[model samples]
Target: MSNAIDFISAYNTIDSRLRAIYRGKGNLQFSDLVRRCAEFNNTVRKYEDDLLLCARLRNVIVHESKKDRIIAEPCDDLTRLIGHVAELLSMPPRLSVLREKNVTGIDAEATLAEALVRIAQTNYSNLPVYRKDRMIGILNNRRVVRVVGQALERGEDVDVFLQTPCSQILQAEDMNRFYRVLGRSDTVQEAIDAFEDNRKLLAVVVTESGDAGDRIVNLLTSADIPMLIRILEE
Candidate 1:
C-alpha cells in the first residue's frame, strides 16, 4: 500500500513537471498532458513507453475506491519504474556530464606525424582537425591508415607521406560520416539516438548550442553509450 502510494506520488510529480514545461512553451491546454509531452521534441519523446505505463498505473490508483485496492503490494519492478520516471521527469542527464576542460585537436596545418604523436599520447581515436578556429574535419586512425596505405601503394616515400598535412587527408565526401555536433542542453537519449542512427558516426561533439562553430564542450564516442545507460538506470 505504501509503495503504491509512493508510485502515485511519483507520477504526480512527473505530471507537474511536464505541465510546467508545456506551459513554458506556451501550451496552456493540460487536458492531454501525456500526448502533449509525446509531441514535444525536447522532452520525453524517447520515454513514451514508460510514460504510458505510468499513466495507466496512475489511473488505477486514482480511480480505485476506498473499499477496493487493486495494487496492494508493489514489487521491485514498480519501484524501479517509478525511479526511472522520476529521473526522466526531474533531472535527465545532459551532455555536460562528459564535458572536459582540455579537448585535443589537430591543426589543419599540422603534419600527420604531429597528429600521430597526439593520438599516441592521448589514445583518442577521433581527433578534431581545425583550421584557425574553424573545425574542418576529424583525424581518426582509419582515415589516416587509408591515406597512408594509398600513398604506400603508389610507391611514395614513407617519410614523405608521414609529413603530409592533416588537411590533405580529409576527404570531402567522408566528412559527414565522421562526427556530429549536439547542444549542451540535449538529453543523453538524443546523443544515443544520433550514434545509433548513423552507422559511420565516430563521435558526438557537444557545444553551447549544437552549432558547428560553437566551442566544443565535450566529446562522446560509441563506447560511452553503455556507461550512459548504466548511469541513467541508477
Candidate 2:
C-alpha cells in the first residue's frame, strides 16, 4: 500500500482508540482528542506533537487533491513512527513483557528476621507479605527501618522486635495509597504512569484479575523504572 494509505490507516486507528476512551461524549475532533487524551495517557503525551503534525499532514493529503489524483504522501519514516504510536496507544505491552518469574513473597507469620533473610537472599528491597496466599502488603526496607528506629527510640529490646511477625508491620500499611494493583490487561505504560503519579508508591502488584485478594503474577518496584522506560522506548 502507498505511504498515504498506510499513514491514514494508522491515524484512523489512533483516532478510534482515543475516541473509545471517551465513549458517549459525542464525536470529538481529531486534534481535540489528542489534546484531551494527553492529559492522562503517557503514550499520547509523548507523541502529542507528532500526532498533531500528522493531523495537519493528513489534511494536506486528503483535502489538497484533485479528482483521481493524490496530492501528497507521508514519508516512510513518519509513517512508521505514527504506526508505532498507534500500536502503543491502542494495545500497549503488558506487565508480562517484563517476564518476571519466581516473584518472592514472605508469609505474614514469618519473623522480621526471617523476612530480612529472604530479602537478603533475593536481593529484593520490596517483598510482598502474604496471609493465606493473599497479598496483604509489601514489607520494604524503609518500613522495616522505621519500625526498628522507633524501637530504638524507646530503648526496647532490638532482638525482640526482630522476632516480631511481619503481620505487625503490615498493620501500618495503607495499601490503598502506598501500593497499586494492576491486572493482566493493564499495559506497561499504565504501570509507568502509576509510579510517575505517586512518588510514595512502594510497589505495584500484578495479579491475574487485578485484585488484592488474587495471587501476585508479578511485582514492580521503583528500581524497575529504568527497565520499564526502556521497554516503552524500544
All models, RMSD in angstroms = 6.5, 3.0
Cα lDDT of model 1 by residue, 1-234, tens digit: 467777777777877878865665555433367677666433466666667777776676667635565544456687667667766778877777764647789889999999999999999988888888877777889998888899899999989999989998887666577788888888776787787779788888887888876777788889888876665555
> What would the TM-scores of all predictions be?
0.67, 0.82
Backbone clash total for model 2 is 0
Evaluated at residue 168, the lDDT of candidate 1 is 88
What C-alpha lDDT does candidate 2 achieve relative to the native structure?
0.85
The candidate that wins on TM-score is 2
lDDT of each: 0.75, 0.85
Q: What lDDT is reached at residue 138 by model 2?
A: 81
For residues 1-234, what per-residue lDDT tens digits would candidate 2 score against the true structure? 899889999999999998976453868889999999888776777888999999999999888967777799789999999999988877788887667557899999999999999999999887888889988788888788898899999999999999999989875446777889999778887798898899988788889889977978888878888888778777
Stretches off by above 4 angstroms in model 2 are 19-42
Output the lDDT of residue 89, model 2: 72
